[model samples]
Target: MSSSLVVQDLGFAWPDGDRVFDSLSFTVGPGRTGLVGLNGSGKSTLLRLIAGVLRPASGTVHTAGSLGYLRQDLTLDTQMPVDELLGIADTRRALQAIERGETDVAHFTAVGDDWDVDERARAVLDRLGLTHVDLDRRIGQVSGGEAILLGLAAQLVRRPEVLLLDEPTNNLDRAARTRLYEAVAAWPGVLLVVSHDRALLELVDQIAELRDGEIRFFGGGFSDYEAAVEAEQETAERLVRVAEADVRRQRRELIDARTKLDRRVRYGQKMNDTKREPKIVMGNRKRAAQVSAGKHKTMHQEKLEQARERLVEAEEAVREDDTIRVDLPATEVPAGRTVLTVHARLAHVGHQVDLLVRGPERIGLVGANGAGKSTLLRTVTGELAPAEGSVDAAVPLRYLPQRLDLLDDRLTIVENVARVAPDATPNQIRSRLARFLFRGTRADQVAGTLSGGERFRATLAALLLAEPAPQLLLLDEPTNNLDLTSVRQLSQALEAYRGALVVASHDEPFLESIGITRRVTLPT
Candidate 1:
């Protein structure tokens, strides 16, 4: 069977008025491919379309395989054993039936070659870093990450012709992410993945970027896509300038032609003051003059219309091709000499380490899942408060939590930001929201209705509105819903920021790019 997927002119919208997909289209084959886009940009929706779980609003999706998808929406009873979730025994039978073309698409039953299925299922389970998950253990007893691994094992056992995974590495650690890259790199089947992990994208053969309601394919990896986008930005700026000038010139030419035509019409209307040779001659002259005037006016109007069309085209080029602006308005804060000092602070998980910070230090907190990373960040921010040791926070601090709870769920974005810092005026709030790309009419949209990325931005915008920027900024998984381009923009903003930067993220490149030189390693 051929291993490939073809999606054409796909689009989908929610019944509630949100547009989930807008003319998304792409093709994939039997190789590693990465799907990168902002959260709610329909990356997951597109995967569902290909998986046949969700139908497109108006397009065709053709798949050439027995499909398997690992969505984050996996629902497993906590009390169920992980082995049962894997369906190891059942998957074995399914593979056996497929091998002989014995099972119809409608149902599956165990008859022959059942033992072979078990062996294949075991091999797949082992490959997914689940070598230690006992086939008999209940999954409810394991971590969220572990449950996903079991789900992955169940899917891979089928040896599907096509596989679609969304946010597969979200709950994984550094080591687990590495193992996933290695596993897919050697796999021989069509793979479509949606992930925020840059490390994973580097292993893919092609990159499909979903942005601005369109899908654009780049032949190379993520690095290539970055460079290509940069080149495009440069080209777009140059073209916009050219278009602006041409539009102005066309408008001026159109005005000049209109002025000349008006003068001719005035001259024709005021004629007949001069004596004519005879009555008939005079009549003919009058008729000829009117005909000339009519043709001249018609041609002049046509030229004006043509010039106006050119201007429209130029403006469209400028509006549609402009570069994305990621600038953040960060204030230079007057921080205290000491931001935070941890005295022999021990993590709740017993990683067994002390963390100390002096002045404005750009630090990164990183560890595998189930590690004490979040716990440590909370300690630093005075949220959990050290249970066993002395902690000191010398400056005003603000924490950007992983799950944003600070934002008001019911208020409009403008109202929420306004409610946070009640001192700011409406005009000031409008100006601030615009910086985060929620300009004009969007400011009034309900905060709860916004997408993850937009919600994150709204919270950040409020943080910036503080009277004095928090001398210390603590961010938790800030890049989760952000696209790579948006992340780069945030990175640039952080690079320009002067206050202390404390970030907890799985994005190694983003941390490195943001000038994080020191590490407060959270214990595993």
Candidate 2:
């Protein structure tokens, strides 16, 4: 068998908080791998650990080859020109000669070093879709998407044996994402990618799912892996049901035994006292009562142990209901066919960004970095006015910002909902939030410490109970940092929603799930 990256009996916990990974072990060889998990599930941390950026709290991460990591940090020197960053022809030639293990200058220059170095640099740039870029251009003026491509160029130049990418497709257009995926796919090295792009998952050979810091391997592409997960969940649900039934049965038997023991002991005591005939008869009755009492105690102990075991077994079947609930009720649509209008003119930040919504049309505006997608979203939601064009929303609109900042951080989820609809009584708000899975103390729990999905759910709770519900719902990147389950739940909720759904997201799968009816393309 070929050597691969291996982690054995690893356990890690944040010094400030709870443990994220415990006794986690896995192995990956030379192949395409997909790393998937919920937000804050340690996928990014694990990637960093593999890259040697973070030390494991226990155990070991061993690898047989050099590793490369593309983290979220992107820093470019705006003052330095491209040539200075990439080096001159002579420098490039010297670097290449050193890599080839040739020290003699005459030998290195004999085959026309300039031509060779230029060709090599151009080839790297071409592979990374940077052939058209001006080599002398400063990196600062370039867009974020371009910076990502440049980073890929640098990593490819090193030619590492193992590569790890952390959300490499974020803030990128379809063309850029395609380019990034192809580059990683073509590289003859072990690759592990953390991405939400469905297209990228198709290129992977296998997937590793991380939930609650535990990892489970799912062989094959996304489709196969999804089917496997669903099957496993079904099996887990069955185990829970069976264990619960056994616990009830054992409890009943224990209760029956205690009842019988009580009757026998009472009968023996009464008869012994009433007879008062001989010491032998009295002693026999007393001994019989003692035996019955001992038997009862043993049965009680057995029942207690059985109940504890059943609880553990049930937990083994499935973990806690960690699945955050996400459901919302949108307002009714206006009767007319055309519900909104955008007059054509220069928009916010002075651009020609115009849009319109008819009835309950679902529209998605897609654009490259710095193309004013957010600006347009803010304009439509009434947070910002266009520089020239005007947006006409027929009725009250509810907006779910990208960060969901509308929710008050200091209050409980239930409190947040109440404040949104001040006219609603406490009971009405609590009952409405309950439908969104915030019940009892959960509703009382402070919203500031909630997870991203939980915060999103809380925000949805507020939107639903608020008066004059937005006939139009505007969401921005609703699934960017969300898990697959959360995204799926949100998609289902939106699909069932009767109001107009306008979402701004880079996730193709999520967009399709929410039923995007119209699209507006933005220039790169």
Candidate 3:
């Protein structure tokens, strides 16, 4: 009656000879556990391994009960009915057939003991805020958020003892997020969610962080986990300081010891030259002094080396949370300066909106799922034409679309940036790219090879470093698919950007982090 998931000495690598995890082991018990890490840290890979979607290069994964996994990207066939997607289509059909008086044993067999399957399905859908959706409705009629919820509902109705969800809230709006949170809060089985959503992470019983090809577990929720990590970092830094001091002290002692040995050798040489003692005695005394000096030098050198080793070990304990650093004075906007003007009628969605952005305004575009936030952004960026009205930018502008498809996959990161900033030399491009944390060979990496977070950084780099320097930036759901660290990095990069920003995102915390000055809500 009990269920658990365990991994033993798991090893996996990509076909490109890049190793992700090596001899990594972890366990998930009953209760919600949040898996967090930077992009490319193999969090998703581990989840897929546990779900049996991927096989490890080495080791075993054992599960005590049935397992269910809800992937982040739910690519449901739009033409499929909701009932079929939920895995109850056959049972529902059999019940209907039995009601028609067929008396077929096969129908009864398919119905099984759960005669109220229809009611259960409806109830589950209602709980997930899909009450308006009927079983016969095709997925194409529903929104992205509805699809994700249906996916979760599919797994929940099965009542599996082990459940896995990967970024389940990526496309969900605030209301859908609340429902998902409640489901996670009440999950009785082992729930491992890989997410960057801070609010969702706060609901977890514990946090499992995958970093540097290893898994580290922390008790309690995200806040508790953060506090523990900070405390540990403080301790690690203290140890590093102590070790550094020891190294310095050992070096000083070694130098002093050498000086003393040299002085003693000089005195012994003087005595030998003066012939202060008999020849045989002098010779024996000289030999003893030389041996003593050698031993002293050896001991001091050994201590110094030991101290250096300790320092290295101590330094290794410290974690590196590198943030981006940039200088963008050209992006600065003065007060009362007109940055953008939006006068558009979204006839496709039956909404008309007018807005003006001035100075260094930070505007947050908020709306329900499928309410045309992305559409509005595309219109503002001139990628789409509204039925009536126009968008005008008074300064240089750049738009970062939701898909991050702004870069050419065949080009290197440096070349991508150079394409946008044609006048800038490769060295200048590399120099600016380093501020985005793409330095050395990383700057030379092809855009296709970068991870989700790295690609976001590269795309942002290309836009911000473009020729003429954008004074107005448009980003559509920039936080989607980004890890928490990448989210922070984006925030940090935008902090340095003095341009007018209009970002469409459902992430409240991230929006607040960048200091939004205005809010634009699309009508539902």
Candidate 4:
């Protein structure tokens, strides 16, 4: 059978009674499909269900052929050898045994017809930019980016008919991303990927957006999907305006009809009181008038109800793109003020760096996976002392680490922000948190319970809302693991910041979106 994946009437819910999907269904043929959604919209869960990593509550997932899956978290035993991770260690051992003249049928069975498994594994590794990675090396010895690549390499070596990748480009640098992109572009199977990386999304043949408990397939890549959505929103907004006008017109007409009926009744009563016509004739006229008025009122009421329904439907069509909006005048530094200075060798990479930041300058810190970009950011924030130099900051600064560990997991979102801004009242903190899209009771959610996107927003809110205000900000891979919307929200939040910024990131598009003033690359 041709490679295909089909899901029929899929239903899933968490054990906590949180329903994620109900009767969701979609099919994938042999081509690249990029799955996208908001942070908790069940994209990952859907992929897991399809891959059989998680059992579905209901419905059936059918695959035509073999399947390979690369999960986002990529948890693995650090002590495992690279060959084992690549899934060729046993085959290689079997092949070696046969070469040693062992007359063992089990060894031949293990080897099968794949005597060149090691060579194929090495080729796949090399294709993903892991040429230097030895098969016998421990997984712990590789960088995080390399480990992600290795997982992909392992999947590619299996040559499955269907492949599912979730957030494959999370920690990959530009070069590694390029290599992965090439691999994705060349895949000849039913490939479905869940990712927030715009570049990776652009490589897909089509876009599948999971939203509001449903999946919507759009022709072409991310750009095409965006254009279609923009057009749809425009039409929806126009319809909403038309519906509102119709409702208003109906209301006015209803009021006019009521006024006319009241005037007619009063005129007829005055005439009857003056004995202008017989009592029976006047009574009959009054009853007929009452019936006419009721019909007119009911007609107008039905028209108004219909108009209101249309308005609601039109409004629903328009998507809500909530973004961060804030004004941080307190964080503004003087035009010529020295915000930060660092003159020392980075501890991890032993790279010499001399940097001076002034005013509200924005700097993008970029390097390979093991180039110590995080180390340099820590040194700038005084979190880690420089190996051979002194660091100075003229004003208060805040750091947002890659792991988003700044917030206290036990504390509520409001409490976390309040911890940083001690002088601000609970109400004051909540009012500001609203600008970060945490309104009402949402601010009361514990940090530990928040999704990846929520935690990023909460951490950012706390960082910017701190006491005395931060005049400088240091962010390490701030866009890592964030959804596309959250990344855009982060950019929106940073746009309002007046402080000097030193951001370490592998996401070049994000750095550009946030308007980086200059780029500094650390040596490997």
Candidate 5:
């Protein structure tokens, strides 16, 4: 059967009167579509509305055939058996009861048309690269990446015609991500996904961008969408230039008209003073000249105003996603300079990690979700003592942890930076903060009310702008929830910082974007 999803005249608002979307309409046909947007552009909210997880204030969602949805934050029961996670525990139990000589009608009813359910579950799990995970095992025994795969298997077992996935690659490792990507490529049904992972988005058939409470669809993958946007922006900028030129021409014309009116006024006054004609004739000529002058002045003024309005409209059509700019001389590291060393035995990473970081080298820590990456970072930062061995840093160090809990929520953005850099005056701090896109009153707003991207920027500003600038920076899963543009912005900011960087992440494209020079792999 043909499958599709449609949204019509959708409107939603928060209880605090913050309008998220209004009069939005879009459609998803039987193909893979990737949704892209900025942090607060309501991508996730739109998915929720279609998945029936959230109620809309107005309008409706229509879907043909059965539907399935996988949200970013899946609530898993650790104690539940693997069979339960695959959504086949009841059918398996009925088969067991029948094998034990039970002749109850309820057993037959439970096993109706699904006598082969157990075999199908095993096959699906194997296909999703979970061959080692047995149906009898508990969910707690497997790693996080395996758990996410199991979630996908559960949705596939139902064979729904329409599927919605939100950030499905958030915690998957590289190898596991490849398995999920393969599954997405083979899905022969309507699929819609929201993700920042470039590799995953590359597999989609089309791209849907949600911005300013509207949906715009582009043909092909991420690269195609980027090309289309660049072309559109170039056209918009050209229009702005044309409108600016028109405004200048109108201003010049208005000035020339004013000058001509002044000269005519003097000539009329001179004719009256010299009595060049009869008194009535001179009076009539003077009144006519004044009326004509008023009309000409009004026409030129109106034309200038209209030209300026067109310029404003043309400029508004262009988008400006500002980037950060900072110069930290103290953060630079000389070539061949020793930076840090780690010789520790982590709890999950069995092998003892002994390595040296020098100069401005970038290191990427790659591993599965439960492979002790965060633990190693904490150990390196002295937040958690290593189970064994030693770690040392020769330069100033700062760690941007996975949770980004470094800032004080009650304090304003400027105050938060000030707390970290006590020597810098408020004016100096504000001036530096503006480079991170926290200018004017935005810097004075309390940190508790910031959106995800804003909070990330504020945290980054506090870390980079602190006194005694850090020469070695550590980041954990920095691109987990950031939009693609924000990820690019982060890469740009890091490009300006001449310091050693150690990042722990599952995003391969982002890791490549930051120029990783070395790799550290942990055992699964």
Candidate 6:
């Protein structure tokens, strides 16, 4: 049977009654489709609903064939073996039992036909660049990137007709990402992936964007989708300009019409006061003039109203590009100042390095998965002590880890920022938070309640807005799960920072955008 997935009139809402989608509908046939949207746009939710992990409040999801789903956050037992994760442990056990001459009917039933699950699982793993992973090895022994690949391998091993992947490349390094991209490119089944990885999206057959409770399909890859959106925005902006001009013209015409009506009224009053005609004739002329003036005023008013409405409609068509706008002058360092110095052997990679950061230099840390980039950042933050060597910072330092655990979940965004900037008043903290896009009531939202992008913004705001001000900042895979817009926002925020920066990320585009002065690579 051919693979097909369809959704009709889907409606969903959170338990708190916040609606995400209402009467939403879309379809996915055979081929790879990239799902793109801003954070909290219901992409993940829609995937979960289609995967049957979450039930929709209304509407139906239909699948024509078997399905496999890989969630963004994998919850697995650390002690579970690789075979168990691959969902072949039972079959493997049954095969072993049959080999031992334990010809039980139950064992045969468990083994089923085509008893080569082990080899198939191994092949899938190897294809995903996990050739070193042993069937007996535990999940905790592998790196985060390896674990993500393993999750994908598990789905591939199942040979499902339809596969749903949500942010599958979040923790993958460049090499791992390349392998995943190749796999995605080769997928023959119906595949729907929710991701912010540009390279991965580039491999898709089409792009499906979820926005404002609707799905928009764009042909070809990410570049095509981007060009299409750009053209649309350009047209929308042009229409806005046209609408504004129309509104202005209408307003001027309305004013002129009122002025003419006023003049006519004054002239008629003067003529009546002068007794230029008989009383009956003057009365008829006054009523006729009043009626004509009212009609003229009403016609201009309607035109002005129509123009204003068109202006509103045109403005709404333009997308909002809310960005971080702030100045962190406190983070500035003198050209000759040493912001950070480190001489040590990285804990995980055992590489010796002597590094120095001066002034407002930006450094990009580039390496494959398990190459100790994260370890180096942690060591710099003093969270993890180096096995051998000294590290020093001449000014206040801050670190934004990949986990983004800096914020206190129970506190509001305002309170979280205030925690780091204790000297700042509530109003002062809120004012700064607004620049992070958490304005007014949004600033009062609890950190735990924020979406992924919101939480990242709040955490970044807290770190940058700290009382002492960070002169040296360390970031580990900062753009891992950020949507494209959020990534831009992050770059915008960093552009205003005058501090020395050390960022470890696999996203080369992001690194370039943030103005990296140099790059340091750690060997695996």
Best of the candidates, lDDT: 4
Q: lDDT values of the candidates? A: 0.72, 0.74, 0.91, 0.92, 0.90, 0.91
Tell me the tens digit of each residue's lDDT in model 1 across 1-524.
Answer: 67789888888888887787666677788888888877677888788878888877888988887888998677888777554566564554465567787757532544244445555656776777777777667777777777777777777766788888887777666667666777778778998888777877888888988877888888677888778877876766676676667656766765776677677656644554454356677667667767876776677667667666765665554423212244333434444456677764555665554665665678888777778777777877767766577777676677888677788889998888786668889998888777677889989989888887677667777775665556678898887656665676566556656677788877787788888869776666
lDDT tens digits, residue span 1-524, model 4 = 89999999999999999999899888999999999988999988988999998998999999999999999999989999999998889999989899999979999999998988888898999899899999999999998899999999989988999999999999898899999999999999999999988889998999999999999999898989899988999999999999999999999998998999899989988988899898999999999998998998899899999999999999999887577999999999888899988889988689888889999999999889888888888888778887897888889999998888889999999999989999999999999999999999999999999988898899999999998899999998888888888998999999999999999988888899999999998878
Highest-TM-score candidate: 5
Off by over 4 Å in 4: 103-105, 408-415, 423-431, 439-451
By TM-score, highest first, what's the ranking? 5, 3, 4, 6, 2, 1
For model 1 the local lDDT of residue 87 reads 58
- Name the candidate, 2 or 5, with the larger lDDT value: 5
Q: Which stretches of model 5 miss by more than 4 angstroms?
A: 101-106, 347-350
- Kindly indicate the candidate among 1 and 4 with the higher lDDT: 4
Model 2 pairs whose backbones collide: 347-387
Rank the candidate models, highest lDDT first.
4, 6, 3, 5, 2, 1
Which pairs in model 3 have colliding backbones? none
**How far off is residue 70 in model 3, in Å?**
0.6
> Which residue runs does candidate 1 get wrong by more than 4 Å?
8-11, 17-26, 57-59, 90-126, 211-214, 269-271, 274-336, 344-353
User: What TM-score fits each model?
Assistant: 0.85, 0.87, 0.95, 0.94, 0.95, 0.90
lDDT of 3 by residue, 1-524 (tens): 67899999999988999999889888889999999998889888888988888889999999889999998766899999999999999999999999989898999999999899999999999999999999999999998888999999999889899999999999898889899999999999899999999999999999998889998999999989999998999999999999999999999999999999899889888988998888999889889988998999999999999999999999999987568898888899998899888788875886887889999999999989978888888887777798898888899989998789999999999999988899999889999999998879989999888888889889989989998999999898988899988898899999999989998989888899999999999889
Please write out the lDDT profile of model 2 over residues 1-524, one tens digit for every residue.
34368888777788897787888898888888999887678898898887888888888988777777788665777866655555553465565676789888764564344545556666877876777877667888777888888777767765678888887877776677778878877878788888776778878989998877778888897778889877877888887787777778777877877788788877777776787568797787678778877877787778767776876776676644544343444466754556667774435345675566777778887766677777777887777767775788776777777667888789888778777688878887777776677777789989889976677777766776677666787887776666665676576567656677677767777788778898887554
lDDT measured at residue 238 in model 4 versus the true structure, 0 to 100: 97
Error of 4 at 447 (Å): 4.6
Please provide, for model 5 over 1-524, each residue's C-alpha lDDT reduced to its tens digit, 9 standing for 90 to 100.
48999899999998899999898988899889999999999988888989999999999899998989998888899999999887889989999999999999999999999999978998889898899998999999988778888999999998899999999998888888998999999999899999999999999999999989999999999999999999998999999999999999999999999999999889989988998889999889889989999999999999999999998998888887577888888899998999999988875456577879999999999877778888888888898887788999999999998788999999999999998899999999999988999889999999999988899899999998877899999999999888888888888888888889999999999999889998988776
- Model 5 has an lDDT value of 0.90
**Model 5's TM-score against the true structure:** 0.95
